[model samples]
Target: MTLQPKNMLNRLLKSLLVSFVCIIVLSIIINLTAIKLPILTEASYERYLILFLYLIVMIFYVSLLFDQLYLSQKAKGISLFFYLFIMTGSLQLLESLVAQINVQPKAIVDVIVYTLVITSFTVLIFRYYGKGAESYTKRIKNYFSHQHISKWLLKCIYAIFLLFIAHYLINSMLTPFIEPYYNGRYTNILKMSHHAGDVKYVSMLTHALVMVVGFQPLFALWKGSKTSLLFWFGFPLFIILAFQPFIFNVHWPLGFRFPLFIEETLIMYIHAIILVHLFYVPDETHKEEELVKSKLSLSNW
Candidate 1:
């Protein structure tokens, strides 16, 4: 959270190295289990091009994850496990389910194993390359911070509404460009009701809640450093949702998926900055300063 630009670059490169090693190990595991994943085996010009961008995006994501988890707050062992297997895990599971194509038990296990290996290496990279950094100087609070239950619920409702609007409006605008690629397959662009029908609303509800309860550590980062906001929040969400379609789908044209990537990443960034403003706890010093100024004005009056 408090890194110099050069150190940030260093951490990114180191984390990328760790991630590549993890990917190698994961590839061996998948091969041993005899699970053929298109993401690994298939290569095309478009695929490789997107894959290269994905790696660039992931290196920063991993590095930022380290800073947000460690320098932003105290990252306990239990908390690290929760973020890896539970917080981030939920988002991954949702996207993976959406990406399924005749998934077998082995494929499911491969996904779980891949998650384990990559997240585990993320921790190792943090320990060796980033463990002792100074904590962020700002007082940060997120949805998990103490608040009246009713107010917390209001924030959740507001977030859900915002997300729906953002997604609906963005998809509406991009539908023409994106619909060409759908090719009679579920003519609707957003696909909100694709397989789940109305049940997808429940899924969206869970997605909102996941942001509330699972991403407290990230709320501060969302409000910091405008130059990096796209990668800090948007890129990770975009990459997760795009990985299967943009990089792995041999038949799906890149032109189709690229718009979704832009759509989701834009929404994610907007959501992050907005939520941080609406619900996050105020900085302690900033809060005190406001209090003092208010009292001084009252006394003068």
Candidate 2:
């Protein structure tokens, strides 16, 4: 399947902007109305919101990659819908796991409801779609052809901000996990199959690695940059350091006392930033140049 044509780019761009605005509005409403919503208590609602945001971010990222790799709108659409379904289903499964662990049915139904919506979307995508499968890439040899220092610097600064948020999140989650590893019960808990506490820690750490390192690079590549040379190498190193909790724990504290509340919020923002960057930035540098060439030729004619 080929990626969507240039004609579709404008539509995708608009959709992304509108979706972002909607997300922000929703966040504001949720915060303002938090006390009134029985279903959205501070602690439980925060977790639910994080999971919800993660699912949306994953959908956007996977769809962009599918578009790049398959080169067809139909394929991209289907791939996105399918990924959302699987992710939602996985969240429900996680709820089930957590329920079994804690022996409580706390906040699982909300997750299931979200999962159902994603499944329905998947069905819609599979019904009416036509496209071919092929690899599509834009080759632009010179990104510096039309230099705008202000815009370039703004984007770079935004990227740096995202990296910083990622760093903070990795530190916050890992420290608590690390503390447990150095305790006397560590070996026994590792051997035990039913240590839900340890499971939660390990799961978060592993998913953080996947999201920051694995998913983040695809987002970077989709933005028409050299993923391997720029982000892929650097991100893995960061992830490795962040994963220090899984190894040794008897070390000096890094003083990562960042508030958990803010940490969760920043992670979602970082996810959104990465996904938004990848979606708006076409991987083929040649794609824009080709359009410019076509226009010039028509003018000459």
Candidate 3:
């Protein structure tokens, strides 16, 4: 799908507006309930605002990626809900893990409440937009038909596994050096598997698998355009931006902070760019289909 500059700009603006509105409404509700959310409570207003802006951009990019998939309107709407649900769920799960280590009652309560809120919204939104349970299932089946799932797409599953292994190894080595400097305060990587015997490896594996699988649709959508200069540049930038949230969470010493930020950002970006270029390629089936259609038209003439 061709992304028009004008249309992309409009979508970006709309995403930003929508995100700002949603966060404001959610913050109001949280305030009224007097529930303490992690960053919302402890973080400065400027920091929160920066996160909101980043979230707006992230959502916009994700929506653009979703649009490229060419799903039905109903399906697209459901996809957004699914995205929000999964993203929030994952963050809350991480927060829960941290709470387990620090024993924060409020953080635990926030996770429960946040899960309920997201789950309720997801159910309500899906019910409103969905035709019926059977129809919904059928819609999903239709979307994931033979045309979309080709050999190239299947290959991404293996690539994702390998990427996760790389991420695990890199994180394992780098985190120890960083954790000591921060005194185990900012880095969740260090805390995730702290005392949890097999739990650490399991959690790391689970998170990597979930993220890779969750992002497969986008990977499949973009696979055909892997060679585009736009993809080459934008993909790495996107990876860097993805790590901003994590970097911002870390409480680094002033001298070490900027360098660490640059270092992690570069590492994540390089890792993603290299992996995508190495493994993801255009689907042969799709190329064949286009060639067949072209030939058929020429023969008719």
Candidate 4:
């Protein structure tokens, strides 16, 4: 359903406020209940990643809840964007939790249990509360047919996610190859001795750029009303903020400056776009007679 241009901005304001409050509450709860737990409170990198994951979940929850309540178009799109993340994250979280409890390394039973649990939760959320109806889903599918350029851009965007996967896999494989170099030592901060020469500033730049590009589609979904603007202006804005530092500062490359910037920019844009899109884009499809009139169904209202 098309939104009236007049009240669109006002609706977006309300959606943003609601999303902010929800995020705050969720953040507090996560910090209070989960952060203090024995597994999480430890100073492990895995624990830190899990904390970040929880924050990401809270962001998606706010976005999805706003879409469900307000039938926001942008929120719906962002919700779709978050579905992929939530599914993948649920898998990781389940595995991590099971391993923590069992005190085993890559236990098959733990893996299976975690996989099933994550899959079930993801399926339930999508089946019951997913935004946009069947018709809108169809429209999104149809969008792929006509928008070859966008589809290509999406592929380019996905290449970044693939790079991360590659990094993870390569890091694992290289551990065996380079074990002799460090003698399989556990350093407080992981140092790159084998790939010391390979890991240059350019590699760091590539990593940063790939990360930002990875979520461009979600940014696209966020800026649905201004898709062209997002592609043209918003993207540049993000690139400048996320990448400019690495271009300038070359000292202490080991610190998380680049990665943190990428993630921060991602979350900010995600929240902003989710807020604006939620109330501005209504139910995806309008009935034959509904478009002729101003009012939507009582169920929608």
Number of clashes recorded per candidate: 0, 11, 0, 3
lDDT of prediction 1: 0.55
TM-score per candidate, chains pooled = 0.67, 0.32, 0.60, 0.33
What are the per-residue Cα lDDT tens digits for candidate 3 across 106-147? 655665564444334333322333232234454444435545
Error of 1 at 80 (Å): 5.2
Residue 264 error for model 2, in Å?
1.3
Q: Which tens-of-lDDT digit does each residue in 201-228 have in candidate 1? A: 4545566667666666555533333334
User: Residue 182, candidate 1: how far off, in angstroms?
Assistant: 4.4
- Which has the greatest lDDT? 1
- Candidate with best TM-score: 1
For candidate 3, which ten residues in a row score worst on lDDT? 125-134
Candidate 4 lDDT by residue in tens digits, 1-301: 2446654554454444433443344345446543222223344565544434443343334333334333334434445434433322332232223111112343344334323333333333333343444444444454445446666566555554454444344434433433443333424223435444344323433553434444443333331333332333334334333333333223213233344344435533443343233212223342234344435545476
Angstrom error at residue 54, model 3 = 1.6
- The segments of candidate 1 whose C-alpha lies over 4 angstroms from its true place after superposition are 1-9, 34-38, 41-53, 71-89, 92-108, 128-146, 180-200, 220-231, 242-250, 285-301
Error of 2 at 47 (Å): 17
> How far off is residue 144 in model 4, in Å?
2.0
Instruction: Please rank every candidate by TM-score, starting with the best.
Output: 1, 3, 4, 2
The C-alpha lDDT values of all candidates are 0.55, 0.39, 0.51, 0.37
Give the candidate order by descending lDDT: 1, 3, 2, 4
